[model samples]
Target: MIADTFLIVTLLAAATVRGAAPLVLAALGGLFAERSGVVDIGLEGKMLTAAFAAAATAAVTGSVWIGLVAGIAASVLFALLHGFACVTHQGNQVVSGMALNITVSGLTVVLGYAWFQEGGQTPLLAPGARFGPIELPGAAALASLPVIGPIYREVISGHNLLVYVAAAAVPIVAWLVYRTRFGLRLRAVGESPGAVDTAGVSVSATRYMALVGSGILCGLSGAYLSTAHHASFIRDMSAGKGYLALAALIFGQWRPLPTLGACLLFAFADAVQLRLQGTPLPFVGVVPVQLIQAIPYILTVALLAGVVGRAVAPRAIGVPYVKER
Candidate 1:
């Protein structure tokens, strides 16, 4: 009984980590863009575009690395477009982001159908084309041990490479944001681009750099979704993960570690919902599928409502900087 209980707990924990990986990546990407005063409402669009690009490319090229590169490149292009409108043309940041999102939502479907003709989805990726789970060293040997063995083998091992990447990204992003020179400039630009400009820093340049980082991270998130989590890129595969990530960012007050915690909370809700589907309970009996599906979103709304008031965004976020004469 104890062993069965441990196995179930480990499985749920692993699922929670898997579900949270994409959110963590997307939220971290948003952190960089928002920290530099750019409101990136197009994270969903970028992820979608990247997912389609990665899957299509991998299906054609039979090389996952090449697909990964294509994904990053596509995301970066969209990020640059966002930067161009918001920073260079002095357009409404929100409008620009929404336009990108709307455009990608349609464009990817159209292109997918035109090229693959599989009802707006890329071909199912073969095992070689997908990001396969990697076993940690000694995972097999350690699996026979007691309590710690199951945790290490099931919870710590057997995830695809991007899962580990997402775990590593948190500390790296924290250091980049709080312990680096560029971080100083990023925070400064977000708070007061005028001050940064007065101090001889190029506000446009800093924000652009931040957007590049944002693009790379979003690319990774999208790639993970299609290549690691699912076998192919389906229409609207990103499904609102980008928005959830933004919510997590706000809930964490735009900080790295706190944002990760919020992501894990949402992921836990998601894992529980999956486990509860079709399962009978003492009082609830078999819950409705729709209600079970809504659990994560409901939790998100509740958490955001509670924290939004206390969570303050960067001062100059969404405002385009004007250089003084």
Candidate 2:
């Protein structure tokens, strides 16, 4: 019985990884944009748009890969729109991002209704049209372990290929942000655009590239949420996880590992909330489900309020760079 309890706890821990994947990817996307002096408040919209695109495309073409591409393309277009406003026009980043979010929120439903007439939801796909995991060389071996290994197999082994992509992206992003020349210049532009400009790096170009990278990552995250996790896209399925990712971004101080940790914390809270709905509580005797559902939001609020201090964001963040005339 003790061994059984340990196995169950390990399984929950492992499952938290899957629950955290979307937020991790989205946070990584926000990391690129924010670290490069772009405040992508529209990430929520971008994810929603991508999710809708992925589901619609998959439903029509019966190809998950095409759906993923379509989702990324759509997110890129939206991110470019934000880039045009903030980078080119020197518009207010917050206002521009809010506008984009509102635009996608409305446009997706209208277009989705027009295209598929499914009342803002897309048809579910067959198994082949959805994303699934790959069995790595040693994956089978991992599942056979006594306690911890079984938990990994049950929770992580059957996840979609995008899960691996999302996990791999953390180190890749960290390396790109810290080790590469482009990463150095990207941070320079964010920290001090004037310095970056004096160094002969194209500040505007770097910011645009960062935004585009953000688009691809967020789009991929959204596609995974739709085709890989749920197999169908609900309107506004993102449900503000983009904003949560942004919070994790600030909470982690713009670093990859810390941001992933923050994401896991939130995901764990979410998973606990879901799991609690099934059990009976002593004394309280059946707490309201809404109270349980609010756990993530409550944790987020508490972290933002109590834990965050005077953290300095990138110097050029939210400030449009202007080349000297």
Candidate 3:
């Protein structure tokens, strides 16, 4: 009984990390864009488009690498378009983002029908085209060690490469946003674009660059979803994770470390729900499936309602830049 309990706990912990990986990427992407004063509500659209591109390309070429490249390219294109409308033309950021979201949601379905004729999904990828868990070197050799070996194997190792990438991003983002000159300028641009402009920086350029970075991260998240987490892209496969990422950003107060914690919190809730589903408890006979699915979203609303504290956004966020002559 004790061994079974230990095994269940370890499995749930690993699952939480898995569920949080994409959210971490998307939340970090949102952080970069918003830190540069760009409201990227279109993260959903970019992710959806990238997922389709990745799945379709992988299905065709039988190469996840090519699919990853295609996905990032597609997302970068969409990000540039958003930049064109919001940064260049000074369009309403929210409206433009929503429009992009609507456009991509429909466009993917149409393209899927035309290309693969699978209604709205791309063709299922081949074994070589999908990413699966890779057992690390020395993983087996260490299993005889004490608690550390088993914990390392179950929670820290055995995930695909993207999981490690997501884990690495936390420190990288922290350094980029807090330790670099460009990070200083990026934050300044978001808080006070006029000041950044007065300091001889191009506000549009900074924001556009931030959007590009955002695109890369979002694309990575999408590719992981289609190629690593699942073997194919399903219609609306993102399943509102993009929005959930935004909530995580909000809950984290836009900081890299805190935002990571927020993502893991949501992911942990999801893992718990997965474990609880159809399980009998002391008081509860069996947990409902719908309630299990809703746990993470319910936490989102609670967080947004000030469960922890007020989440303050950047000062000049969502405001378009107009250079003063």
Candidate 4:
């Protein structure tokens, strides 16, 4: 009984981490954008574009690395477009983002049907084209031990490279945001572009850089969705993960570590929902699939309703900087 209980806990923990990986990557990407005073409502669009590009490229090239690059390139292009409109033209950031989202949503489907004719999805990826789980050294040997062994083998090992990248990204982003020179400039620009401008920093440049970083991270998230997590790109594969990531960002007040916590919380809800599907309870019997699926979103709404704390955004977020003569 104890062993069975341990196995269940191990599986749940692993699922939670796997589920949280993409959210962590996307939320951190949003953190960079919002911290630099740009509201990136197009995260969903960029992620979908990247997922399609990555899957299509991998299916054709038979190389997941190449597919990852393609995904990053596609996402970066969208990010740059957002920067061009919002930063260069001084356009309405929200409008530009929504337009991009709508455009990508439709464009990907059209292109998928035109090229692959698989009903708006890329071909199923071959084994070599998708990311495969890597077993850490001694994972086999350590699996026989008690207690810690299951945790290490299941939770700490067996994930693909992107999962590790997502874990590492949190600390790296924290250091970049709080312990680096560019981070200071980025934060200053978000809080007060005028002050950053007065201090000889180009506000536009900083924000654009931040968006680029955002694009790269979002690309990773998308690539993970299609190549690492799923075998192919389906229509609207990103769903609303980008928006959830944004919510996690706001929940964490745009901080990297706290944002990670929020992501884990959502992921836990998701993992539980997956486990609870068709589960019979004392009174409920079998839970409805729709209700099971809605658990994560419901938790998101509850948290945003001030269960955690008040979330204060950057002062200059969504306000384009107009330089003084």
| TM values, all candidates | 0.95, 0.92, 0.95, 0.95
What range of 10 consecutive residues in model 4 has the weakest lDDT sum?
Answer: 292-301
Across 2-74, the per-residue lDDT of candidate 2 in tens digits comes to 9877866766776678778888888898888999999999889889989989988999999999999999999
The segments of candidate 1 whose C-alpha lies over 4 angstroms from its true place after superposition are 282-309
TM-score of 2: 0.92
TM-score of 1: 0.95
Error of 4 at 84 (Å): 0.6
Q: Write the per-residue lDDT of candidate 1 for residues 234-277, one digit (tens) a residue.
A: 99999999988888888778999999998888788778778878
lDDT of 4 by residue, 1-325 (tens): 8878778778999999999999999999999999999999888988998999999999999999999999999999999999999999899999998998899999999999999999999999998999999899989899888877789899999999999999999999999999999999999999999999998999999999999999999999999999999999999998899888888888788999999998998888778778877778678688776876666566657666866566788999999899877
Clashing pairs in 1: none
lDDT of each: 0.91, 0.85, 0.90, 0.91
Q: Which pairs of residues have clashing backbones in candidate 3?
A: none
Give the per-residue lDDT digits (tens) of candidate 3, residues 141-235: 89888777887899988999889999999999989999999899989999999999998999999999999988999999999999999999998
Per model, state how many residue pairs clash. 0, 0, 0, 0
**RMSD to true structure for each model, in Å:** 1.8, 2.2, 1.6, 1.7
Name the weakest run of 10 consecutive residues (lDDT summed) in model 3: 295-304
Preferred candidate (lDDT higher): 1 or 2:
1
